[model samples]
Target: MINDGLTDSKFDQRDGIPDAQKMSRAPTVAIIDIGSNSIKLLVARSSPNNSGIEVLYTHTIETRISSGISQAHPRLSAQAIEAGTRTVTELLRLARAYQPDAVRIVATSAVRDARNGQEFTELIETQTHYRVDILDGPEEARLIARGLATDPELSTLNDYLQIDLGGGSLEVILLQKAQIQQAISLQLGAVRLSEQFLLDREAPIDQNTASAIQTHVRKTLETSIDGSLPSLPVVATGGAIVITRAILAAEDGLTIENRSACMTMQEISQLRQRIGGVPLHDRLAIPALPPARADILPTALLTIEAVLEVANADQLTHSFHNLRYGIAAELLEKR
Candidate 1:
């Protein structure tokens, strides 16, 4: 019995359960990630061969927690809270249909920073039979590192660092020989940086503002990492990188077969200047980038550039695997 919008007895009745997906020996689970920019759902099951989970379904809702944000008090707007919670409920409904053995919901920076973030999560739990796990920046970084290591190429990089740029924070992790040596989480994120420096206004971002943004990012990275970094390959993850990878892949007449993309430092530098200099609306024309991400793309790219400098990397590689994958893999392993 339940008192909220959903009852325990009717958990899997909203949509007929997809028992077919569970027929496989691999145990199925739904990985739901609620971030500052989007609510991502990955319905998957562990592969019997222990290779990787097979994705049964995927969905993303542009909840955009950074929208209508108040930097002064660090509070998410009522609209943002409502939109995020509603999206969570909807995704839970979809997850239930898959008859997954587990439904895991994790919240990132936006929820972790908000004044009433826990209240919002409680609201979702009251209405739906789902719990949103709030991950700290450092833990988030470790999970992202694990997820990146899932990629065959990323695992082979003995001295590689992976960075995930989300709307709320940036996670930098250093891995050596497939083991995470060090990981740090920085406050610099696409949405927060945009709100404070880059795209706070509707007009095109000016050159001075852009320079200031870069200076700040540079200083932050310089102070965060103490020693001189080795010139190793860097890997990127998150929404902005995903979009950037797709765009770069299209330009090179290449296809994303392995769910990863690579670009040289020269290419990334050129992209930061060429695309970051454009006005807001023009950003919509970029391949695979939706309007929801246009305003923050410039800042996201700048942050990536900063991370590369910190790592002393000359090239960037991006993988589609991220936090959601890491969470799913962890649960499946435990199961």
Candidate 2:
């Protein structure tokens, strides 16, 4: 659960305003997400009926704060911390322009797994005056599941497997009857795996390295999961997945907005093969692929492919509603 202290309380102190009046009004919230690869801002207002969120703005800045995360005693580098702080400050400033009633900043796998994560958060608080919530693995998974439930299309599904892949960790959630049956976070993130297995991210991944990554992912999933994953629909959300979708859309001469949300295992495999055969510089030439993510995108695709095999699912539905949306919904509901 999100901390009570993080909830909006500005409405509680209206001198002459009645509690009912305050409760009846919609509330706007800003959520700043500090991830291993990027920092994102989402400013949204709840509908009067509290049924949906209307997004006012969204932005992202890649800060790759999880560099060196594959080390035995992983620590955030000084350069990464500085870049992260600067980006967070800028995003916070932008988020405040909408006059949000409440603002929440949360950090995921990168900060939680780092040895000096406290140092990074302290700097942000001292400079920005907003405390960052460093979520543990299970709690992060839970919040992701909560966020996914907010999607109207996804809400109709009674059972499915959800995967949220990030730079530092991969969150896996199994939903049965629209309730979470299992939620776990693994160290199978793209950045983490690239650092661990790929000697040269700038170059194309050779067959041996690709095989090694697949093997590691399969073993990790097998060890973490008690038994075989049920054959349910799979849903994925993350920067990598979004980029993959965009690339596919571009290849088919269609805009990302017009592209289908569902992706098949064969499509993913083909994309991985094509993308993995090229070096980072060559990949940057591809449309809709972000340069910052070019190096690790191959590893990300590999990870996603392995996950699908483990789940015995051939296709995955991509959801734009993620952790921030989930947090935003919570804030609005409290109001």
Candidate 3:
């Protein structure tokens, strides 16, 4: 029997365990990631380790609250802001219900870009009794690195290039020998790019728009990457990558293993064409793909393609992990 808060008996009773019993461990924590396109919440049972921690029990909500912020304005819309508050309120209720040892609420990209971000933070805490902290680009990059290194599936890829594309900002981190070597944050993402380049379009991804997106993504990557890039494997995670997999499956019944896999530039370009060609309504009906994400898929694919081009990576692997995993990993590490 494990001597920690849980036991072999508890493990045996898992099938019939009550919620309260499941949450009996100490240092239960919740990591709330308020992103530009999504607001994700994760409450996990944590176990401390010399390196970091372990986590279980996670959830996500693709709220897209910061959708289209780069061009529309550097601030969140009232509707978006209110939606964020509501989402957090619900998460707080869940955290309370679970009675975690602690809870950490954080806002990224959208909040960082918003002029009224501080005000929104106060509102969330005042109304929900949860304090919200905003992480800048560099910090965001580092936390993600730690998360990738700690994940059981990804831990094996000692050398890898990680891309996390969100609503307002995209973070890229490089790892070698299981340690972070370089990282950068780009002002490019699916929501804003879609608003800037495709809000009025209805045709499949055309050469003109695809070229423009590819150019922008390349330029951004060039600016961010300094020195020589290692021949590390490219691993991508986040809503955009997940959606891309769904599109690939739609085209050829391709099954993604939820881990980083090799993808060619030509294959990705063909995928871009196929995804852009589909109507928004058609995207909404695709199984495993979220309806709210229908319109943003094109823009997300564009950014991803550009990143691949700049990295000059031969292939990319997709992971089911995202910011929530990073947040949960950090919370557990703290204990």
lDDT of each: 0.75, 0.88, 0.72
In lDDT terms, how accurate is model 3? 0.72
The residue-by-residue lDDT of candidate 2 on 1-335, one tens digit each, is: 22232655332333355768655656778888999999999989986566788889999998899999999889999998899999998987787566567888899989998999999998988887777889998988888888898888776898999999999999999999989999999999999999999988889989999999999999999999867899999999999999999999999999877999999999999999999999988999999999999999999999999999999999999998899998888887876
For candidate 1, the per-residue lDDT at 35 reads: 87
Which has the greatest TM-score?
2
Per-residue C-alpha lDDT of model 3 across residues 181-270, encoded as one tens digit per residue: 787888887877777777464556667887897798887788678876776788887777777776666556665553235566677777
Winner on lDDT (1 vs 3):
1
lDDT of 1 by residue, 1-335 (tens): 22222122244444455657434446667877888889999887776578876678989998898653437557777888788889988887787776666677788888888888888888777777566678898889888877765666555577787788888888878777777877888778888888888545545667798778778888887788646556667888899888777677766666655334777767777776767777777777877668888888878877777677667777787787888888778777765
Clashes of each: 0, 0, 7
TM-score of each: 0.88, 0.93, 0.84
Off by over 4 Å in 2: 1-25
Candidate with the larger lDDT of 2 and 3: 2
- The lDDT ranking, best first, is 2, 1, 3
- For candidate 1, list the clashing residue pairs, or say none: none
**295 Cα displacement, candidate 2 (Å):** 0.4
Give the CA lDDT, 0 to 100, for residue 304 in model 3. 84
